[model samples]
Target: MEKIKNLQHSSILFGILFLFLFVIGSGYYLLRKNMLQNHKAQREIIVLDIQTKVESLLSALLHSYTLKKEEIQKKHKEVLSFLQKCGCDPLRLNLTPLYQKLNANYTPPRYNIYITDENLTIKNTTFKNDLGFSLRFAKATFDKHAKEHIIGVSTPLLEASTQKFFSYSDSYIPKTDKILQLSYTYEASSQRFQKIQHFLHKMGIVRATSYIILNDGFINKIDFATQTKEKLAQVIEKNQEDAKKILKTLQTKSRSIRQNKDLQTIYFVVDSPILKDAKVLYSITFDESDFYLKLATLKIVFLVITLFGVVGIIFLWYLRKKEIKLSYQEQFLRSAMHEIQTPLSVITLNHEMNTLKTGENEFTKEITNALQILELSYNELSFALLATKQEHKVEKLSLVEIVQKRVSYFKAVAKSMQKKIIVESEDPSCIMISSIELIRIIDNTLSNALKYSDPKSTIKVEIKQSNLCISNKGKKILDTKRIFERYFREDSAKGGFGLGLFIVNEIAKKYDIKIKVNSTDKKTTFCYHFKEAECI
Candidate 1:
């Protein structure tokens, strides 16, 4: 039966441990999986962001290069220099013919030159509506010391009067209080996509190599190595396989391609804004070795922590099994004590009544003394159980009375052990405490004094108004402080659970009582000072 019970307990504990470990493992796996997916998603987002930025930059660069914006700006500067050299008159020049000759091709000319007078009012201009517009409110400065003041298209300004997206360059005419300004229009952008071109330009990625393949066997490649645009035939000859794969993928509408080996490369295809019926393939690459190394390190660290947790669980399981064994033994002892209580009371009552009816004999006296020892042990164990499991009732108990009663109760046991119990009550006083707790305190103290005293020696128990002291002559305690610790026995042959003094200390602390122990070669004394006591 015991083997079966032990096996059952083991099975339950192991089942619980397995369940706990399973939950931890499952949670760890789920967290690791989630972290990997999140990392991958972040990498994808980065590649996509790079693709968009590169595309925007390339588009702007292509537009600027194709339109020869720099050449036109140089021409505008020369024109401004020529106008500055003219120095004709005060508001007399009409620059309409020059403007018409410059803007003959497009309906809305790309560049418009305007001159401002001392009042910054447009005195000579091409656009008729801006004949008298002031440049003072345009946030453009015409610094006389500087040769030119220019604002780039990155943070383009709107014409105050025409609301056109244009950038301007102005030169102050020396000694004339006049400004020669040239303005040019660029592409319009909504608020959302306004800053991409500016950011790319700031990063200086326009000079880097770029490639864009289309469906109609057209490949536009910007090669920074030669600083030239590679034609379709040249690009095909250089990277035929890659070009073919890109073209085929674009045809099949499978635009997203990723390779995650030594080099993590991502190729994305999106519709081109600059070309006709064409898709642009953007490739982004990253070295994934560092990322994988960190992930591996994290796994190793987590495994180490899991190993430690497993060891801790096993250690706790061992402790729990030991506790279970002690619990079973305690349960059996309590059951036996309960069964013995009835018979013990009957035997005690019958023994006393028979002694009263007949004459006293040595056999009856010995039985009586044995019964007293049995009752002492029974009381200790019974109180140990009751103290843990029961709520006690508080009452005013006379310390003197309780001490005298316990000392008298233990007199027979002391007599049987060839020891004498001597109690001195200096002050008869009462204290507010639980009766059972007070009795246990007195019983345990008296019992210990008797148990540890020298044979045929006197055990002295001193009682005062607020204190109790029990002293005995025995093998001196090596460590007085440790004697009150539970399960700490100086001599195993003394036949005790070593709980008596521990119980005494517990009850003393309950009433704010201070315990003092003194041990020497001659005597060992246990003293309890009651901080709360009512004098009679």
Candidate 2:
């Protein structure tokens, strides 16, 4: 039976513990999933932003190049017309004045004029270094176009030239059999172009490597970490396998991603009117090490918190076990008290009958006294058990009458101790209370007075309109504060279990009865205020 009860109690704790774990586990799982999804979305947005900015930059570069080429063509027409006005005579024209007039139209004038013979060899030139240099590719361009003026892009002849390619226009000077050439090289060192390159270098993507492959096969690497040592623009050979693979991937899909270990590479194809039939491939590699680190940190923190929660549940289980054990002990004590009542009543009844039949003796008187004391202790235990579990029958009773009746009952027990209980009442006062509980309260207080008072002391019991007080001349209660605590005894040698006052307090509290204790070196008083009372 005891094992079953214990199991029943444990089952409740187990149920609560299971519920706690399930709630915490589910919460952690949902939170972790959400965090991972949000992190992936944030990374995608950042990558897309980089792709957009790179496209915008490529458009700007194409526009600048087109503008520079158009300016060079316009200068070619102006120079050709100037030669015609001089009557096709190179000696008759002042080159200095013509150069000044053309240079005034542009910032940092970077134009030069050259005259080439029928053999494609430079005859006269504004730049001194190229005076006799042969134009290897100019003749093919001039014959294919078959026009008076031809504009085309040419690779740099001088290895030390800062520009990879330059724009030049060739015009035939009348009757001279000489081609006038005007060339323009857009310098990469120009302030405006340099600032754009610097902005692209510091594009602000962390742990990412990005590059753009232009139509001209030039790769503009935007990796900021090693950008200082590498050129922003460099031509990639057609045979380079890496560039070929990137171009192949971009052709297959407008956008595609390939993941390797912790890095994911994205290939995006940029479409613009500037590149026309040619495609620009923008590729970026993203490192996900930081994302993994944040997820790992989240897991560790959740584990620590879960560990603490489990410990707290275990602690609660321990406390619950102790409470169950204490409750069982109390149940056992109440059962034992019920068993003692029947036999105790029979013994008291038989003794009274024997004393009535035969004359009383000192031995019988002593037995009677002992039985009364036993009965008093038994009544206290009975009241404690019944008052807590069952509702009592209530009635409007006279407080003065109840006090007088209890005093009379304990008068014989008091005489054996050489003490007496006296009742004092000014008028009849009535209160609505349980009869059994009221008798128990009056009986226990009188019994305690008889037991603890001086042998010859008079215990004064007074009843006013709405109050009852019992004052006895005896040793002062040293710990009056705890006098009404169950099982608390100031002096265990007094021969009572100390439950008398505790029971009184419990019953008083049930009906809103207020109790007060006043103790001194000479006397002690227990007073109860019956606030819900009427006087006649």
Candidate 3:
């Protein structure tokens, strides 16, 4: 039985430990998972923010490049109209001063003009310069979109000499069938670029590279909007492997944002197609050091809190384990004491019978009462261990007989210790209580009075109609109020579990018996005053 009880207690502790571990582990996992999920959302927002800014800027740049077509065609029509009004043909026109006067009227129009004949050969015109050179290179561009009686623009063109990029347009006249084109060179440091730069600044992608790629494989960089003056292509070329991938990916059909990965850094590139075969590929290097630092700090804080919670649970488990052990040990003691009490009663009864039959000296009345008191102590211990009290059965038991029986029981021991016990009753009466419980109550009080009373000093047991009391002249009780408390002792020098008066008080209460203790410097008295029992 003891082994089974121990195993059960052990099982309970193990179960409690496992439950604590499982809860802590699950809480930690969920906390970290939630933090990571939030971090993921933040990262996506950062990426989306970068991509949206680049897309919007590219759209504006494409519009600017394409819109120049209309402006160029408009300027060219003015020249052609002036030529017809003066009755001049493209092959024979010599109006340098008129062209100069027309150009002078424009203010801050950072562009150039050109004139070409049917085969795109430079015709007789005013103010010739190498600025209109890429027009000859883009002859096929005009030829493909050339229409009679129509004016239109060309795809972007690159001047290899100066790295200047521009777009041109052509107008066809039915009167002379002369095909004339105008070239509008791009200003890299234009106010339009400033607008794009301000927009990039708003988007938080400050360190970025932007460029326009031409159909001829030459790059026209957007330098004015970048943080540094270094060319976009040159910076990308520093990482040869990523540069190849970046340039190659820009040519694919998927003109979406792409990644360029190197040993130490990552770049995001998006290419937006502008003209027939040209595109603007924009790339920005991703900076995630701040993001990582914040995430690491969050994890560390959660771990610290989680560590404290786990330690708290372990500490609680330790306290709970102690409580369970105390409970189990108390249960075993109760069971052991209860088993011993049953045989003790049998031995006590048999010894009493033998003494009456043969007047035998094997066990005297003193030894019998001692064993009986020991058995009563076991019963009290059993009740205390169970965290319960003995509910005494009340019946009319004569106090005169109880006192005489207890006095006779203690008489031999009193003589051996040279102490005399006197039972004086003004009125012998009946106490309503269980006979067994009454015996324990009388025995515990009598035992204490005998043990502590000065040897040869008479201890007095008195009985009355309403009460019984035992008075002893011995060591005074330091705390009269605490004598009836369980396991309480004024002097530990006296050997006992200190349960004697406590049990006496318990039985007294069950029978509606009020216990009172009065102590002086050298005299102490314990009295039990019973109420009248309910009559049948």
Error of 2 at 104 (Å): 13
Q: What would the TM-scores of all predictions be? A: 0.57, 0.57, 0.46
Off by over 4 Å in 2: 1-18, 52-322, 451-456, 473-482, 493-498
Candidate 3 on 1-536: residue-level lDDT in tens?
A: 45434444445655775676677668767867887698557645755665565455455546767666666777777877876687756566665655565457556444454556655566644436542333456555455556444676654554444444466667655465456656666654233445555655554443455555666775655432333435533544453233336667555543344334321123344445435566555555433445557667766865776677577667667766766665665666767786887788788888878788888563475676577557656756764564254454657878778779878977876776688899888765665777877887887888888877877888888887768889999988888878887667788887776778887777677667888888887888988887644333
Clashing pairs in 1: none
Q: For residue 294, give model 3's deviation from the true position in Å.
A: 11
Q: lDDT tens digits, residues 252-360, model 1?
A: 6644544434334444567777766776665444445566787787788768767876886787688677767666756766787888899999999999999999968
Evaluated against the true structure, the overall lDDT of model 2 is 0.69
Model 2's C-alpha root-mean-square deviation from the true structure amounts to 11.0
Query: What C-alpha lDDT do the candidate models reach, one value each?
Result: 0.67, 0.69, 0.63
Model 1 regions lying over 4 Å from their true place: 1-28, 56-319, 389-391, 476-490, 520-522
Residue 14 alpha-carbon offset, candidate 3, angstroms: 6.2
Clashing pairs in 2: none
Number of the candidate with higher lDDT, 1 or 3: 1
lDDT of 2 by residue, 466-526 (tens): 7999999989999887988877789789867677888888889888998889999899999
Q: Considering TM-score, where higher is better, how would the candidates rank from best to worst?
A: 2, 1, 3
